[model samples]
Target: MAAIHRLERTQNIPIDLEQAWNFFSRPGNLEKITPAYMRFRITSPPVARMYAGEVITYFIRPLLGIPLAWMTEITHVQEGRYFVDEQKKGPYALWHHQHHFEAVPGGIKMTDIVHYQLPLGFLGTLAGKLFVNRQLEDIFAYRREAIEQLFGSMN
Candidate 1:
């Protein structure tokens, strides 16, 4: 069995909680923050807002432009506070992600916690150690820049 890996990131958005929540809650908005090189594209019908039990499907070229089909269901939602999305079909053995928003002194604090496990047991472990972690970091870095451009700087 592969070991479960965790990744968490938090950023202060220089925007009101409602605006932050509204932008992030829409499934289609993912493409705006994602790196263009990854070719992230949503296959599911466009949604204005997300709710529990919403199933989202996408095609992503995570590596070498090789397209992969990924599906995730919004398993939990608490309106503007938080939401959880769980993988139903994807490359990973498991994927559960939580998005949380809190109104802070300056702006909104957005947090992302992702728990994921790769497939193929030991081979998966090796791949994760060699590249997957770095890939995830790069993706998030891109997201931070994209979001900052959209919502202005937090500092």
Candidate 2:
């Protein structure tokens, strides 16, 4: 069995909790923060609001420009507090993403926690050490910078 990996990122944005939640809650806005190289796109039909049990479809070229179709479901939602999305069909053997929001002193404290596992047993484990980890890091790093650009850097 391959091991599951967890990635956590927390960033304070100079925006109110409502604004932060509104932005992150919208699926269309995801492309803005994602790296251009990944070519992330939401194939799902447009929806104004997110709700539990909503399904979203998308595609991306995470590695080597190989396009992959991905589908995820909004499994849990707590309004302005948090929301969780899990992979229904994607590259990962498992993908569980949680987005959390909190009202901080100056703005919003937003955090993302992802639990994912690669497939292919031993090969997957090896792949994680070789490529997947770096890819994820680079993606998130781009997201962080992009968020800073959109919302202004935190103190």
Candidate 3:
């Protein structure tokens, strides 16, 4: 059966909301946080700040060192609070991601909610169970470490 999957991740960054937003809102900073193996490279032109309706393109080698082109649009933005990116063209049948940030006790709390669907129906479900799910987890796990390395740990 075809299915939709959601991946939610939350992390606390020991930085102010403006600092966190500045870092995350920049399209160029994506490569910095992403794992090198993914080879995430932005093809979009640089912008002073992220804005809604901005379409960004990238080349990523997610598996086997093979490169793939992905395009996504910044569909929503609420300044330092939240933003949503939806895939316009990519490997997935559907991909929508939302990022939210809020001030917490000692830092800013960042949360990511990703809703995606695979393309090949039941085969996709099997693949998600076998690989996709774990890969997503690994990517986020890497992100957590990278963020902490970039900015001191909150713990």
- The best candidate in terms of TM-score: 2
What's the residue-level lDDT of 66 in candidate 2?
96
What are the lDDT figures for the candidates, one per model? Answer: 0.93, 0.94, 0.93
Most lDDT-accurate candidate: 2
| Candidate 1: C-alpha lDDT | 0.93
Candidate 2 Cα RMSD (Å): 0.7
Runs of candidate 2 with Cα error greater than 4 angstroms are none
**Residue 1 in candidate 3, Cα distance off native in Å:** 5.7
Ranking by lDDT: 2, 3, 1
Give the better candidate number (1 or 2) by TM-score. Answer: 2
Off by over 4 Å in 3: none
- Give lDDT: candidate 1, residue 120: 95
Q: Could you tell me the lDDT of residue 57 within candidate 2?
A: 98
Clashing pairs in 1: none
Residue pairs with colliding backbones in model 2 are: none
**TM-scores of the models, in the given order?**
0.97, 0.98, 0.97
Q: How do the residues 1-155 of candidate 2 rate in per-residue lDDT, one tens digit apiece?
A: 89999999999999998899889999999999999988999999978889999999999998899999999999999999999999999999999999999998889899999999999999999999999988898899999999999989876
